[model samples]
Target: MQFFPIFLRSEGARIVVSGGGETALAKLRLLLKTRARIAVHAAEADPKILDWQAEGRLSWVARPVEAADLDGARLVYAATDDAAEDARVAGLARAAGVLFNIVDNREDSAFITPAMVDRDPVVVAIGTEGAAPVLARKIKAGLEAWLPAGLGARVRAANAFRPEAEALPQGRARRGFWAAVFDGALDGRAPEPLDRLLEAHKAARPAVGEVLFVGAGPGDPDDLTMRARRALDRADVVIHDRLVPAPILELARREAEIVEAGKTGFGPSTPQEEINRLIVGRAAEGLVVVRLKAGDPSVFGRLDEEIEACEAAGIAWSVVPGLTAASAAAASLGQSLTRRGRNSDLRVLTGHDVNGLADHDWATLARPGAVAAIYMGKRAARFLQGRLMMHGAEAATPVSVVENAGRPEERILAATLGTLATEIASTELTGPAVILLGLAPRAAARSLPLLQEAAR
Candidate 1:
């Protein structure tokens, strides 16, 4: 919360770094990434500075900075350990109308250098506003994994087509053309400018925007429902999860702009407010956006909020119900949740904190003859199962956990309900998961052999 993030391009900016020690050298190294014109001033410097100067990478002044040094410079940094000199240099830099960072003296600074992660044209600046540098670095490290490797190239590719996009007629048709590009259709790998021109001519037909609420299933691509697969093929943009099957994403229109709408609890995320804004923004632009969710959009998918947002914005949205994580998990084990004549009820629980409706009876999930399929309940398995015992469910009831269900590399671990805690704790599940509880599972297990033989 301390930092306001930003990204700035320094292509034409003149940057002057005043100092020569390791700290100054580090700052200069980061500045080097900008491709900005650079000048360095220091009484003495590390060997790396001399090497850089010798290579003509940067201009070096042997003496301290002067008034003229700040002229026309966009930014100046004083990293000298001497507080007095740092202040004097900062004061002079400010007078010259340049943004300046004074080493370790944020109070006297006109500008504080933000922690940055650069991927040209896709730079991410982390500003704690001078508060949490460690948190900023941690955030940067996390983002490194999520950001694409060739983002700069992809962004440059997007930029290259702006003029053509702007020239296209206004309305859904023009935006749809760009939507195809975002979906990876217009990449240089595909065709040429002529093809785009041809497509534009064909696109004179009326274009209308549609919304598909797709269930991402679990973390396995094969777990995707038949309808989901077809939906993905028609997707213009996939609003997906961190846990959605990667292969599923790859199957979508390659130029599809993927918006990470997954609510990964690990860090701050696009609030529902902003996500709703983004969804309506792109949809209003006439793109077919797939509002992808991890499981069945009906089963605990925050459809209420999303639907309300769309209705408020007067955008057309539709739900394409998917196999919820519970169904996929149960199916992976060949377990029929609503097995005829036995499990009269099939229950699904959020398992996390819930408010409203006079406090949920968590113990009902443990009731016999009712299949209890827990979604995202791993964290509370011990407590959940224990509550089941208190409520009269057998301690040795059959329990199965399906991880990466329906994947080619899928793994199913079986244990008594009592031992699920140890199994889940020790199980090497690296993706989203589901928990199943039922007496019918034993019968389901018996059917797997026949099912396996049938597949052959």
Candidate 2:
């Protein structure tokens, strides 16, 4: 980010503004909201400035601003219309080692004022480094409308109990108490609940940690469920797989410890035992741990093993289902995994099993109307081709390979079973891919023109 958002302590601080017109008034209006001692220096002042001075709202210096004007100022704003004057004030403020902003001049300014949401102790600031003031204001307006009017009051009431909460010990006990309050365990909708929560929190014990197995969906962050998002938001640690997209992980709390437990098909992978141990270990430390898996964790994600591990360790755990690869692949192709007449049952098959090259009922799968979505099938393409062909399956049976389904870079390669292996071999595949058997693409497969091999 060009400008880092931070809240400065304005109470008892000194701030100086140099201008008499609307620009200065705008800056003063925001500054007045803070408890800072404000000083305005202008040769000619606006009537509002005079009114504010008479009301003891601010101090007005009836002269041009000089270097001395910013001697002890924590921040300075130069809103003068004259460019030279603004520059001079900026230079003086910088030389005095004060953070300053020159109105409409971001290049020379040390700070830019952000569109703010004033909810007292629950303030929110939105800024675009002075590049998009209108956008920032729009965002601020949206926030103002969405936030309840009594939010500030509720937050202040909670703040009053912070001292006692802090005394409870520095750990999850204190944090969980506040979390419970915000979660409406204390009825944050009203003020009386705050008093009750404070009294009850004093004797409350620390909450036990939990493990949540959350499905990240097929590379699309928007596909994530609300429950999964909340789990990520509250996660103290996240154990993620290789295929989970970065956007989905971005939903996790910034303070959350992200541990890569990525397992690649036919490649180097974290041992399942080690991953299980890691989850249990983190949860044992009273941390909310999330085992983030790509797509639906229940579908060939080795979820049962992890869940069993948690159960054996006496760790509480839950699951948040997500859109599986089959669904996403079908969506990308504008096709369906199961059709009313074509197929009554849908099967989710893995390309390989414990013995490698998963063995299934080839006769049934190769039946004329059969359909299946195959996961991790890219490497076992030849094996699948041979098996289906041997079982009296038609060489013309349609097949499609969806690479990185639901991602921006997703691609669909379609061909008959006769050329499925050849098409996949000639294509450059990246990211996790899933194969659809007995399902045709919405349009004809665009074949990758292959160069004919010269006779040996």
| Strongest candidate by TM-score | 2
> Across residues 1-456, which tens digit of lDDT does each residue of candidate 2 receive?
877888899998999999989999999999999999999999999999999999999999988799877878999999988899999999899899999999989988999988899887778899888888999989999988877667777778777867767766666667666776776422335444755666687777676788999999998888888998989998999999989878888899898899999987778999999999999999989899999999999999899999999999999999999889899888877787888888999889999986899988999899998999999998899999999999999999999888888777777777789998987787778668898999877753233221121111
Which residue pairs come into collision in candidate 1? Answer: 3-127, 3-128, 182-255, 183-254, 183-255, 183-256, 184-254, 184-255, 184-256
Against the true structure, candidate 2 has what lDDT?
A: 0.86
lDDT of each: 0.72, 0.86
Task: For each candidate, give its TM-score against the true structure.
Answer: 0.51, 0.83
Model 2 TM = 0.83
Which TM-score value belongs to model 1? 0.51
Clashing pairs in 2: none
Ten residues in sequence with the least summed lDDT for candidate 2: 447-456
lDDT of 1: 0.72
lDDT of 1 at 157: 76
Which candidate ranks first by lDDT, i.e. highest?
A: 2
| Model 1 lDDT per residue over 393-453, tens place | 7877887776665556555667677887876777666666667777324445533332223
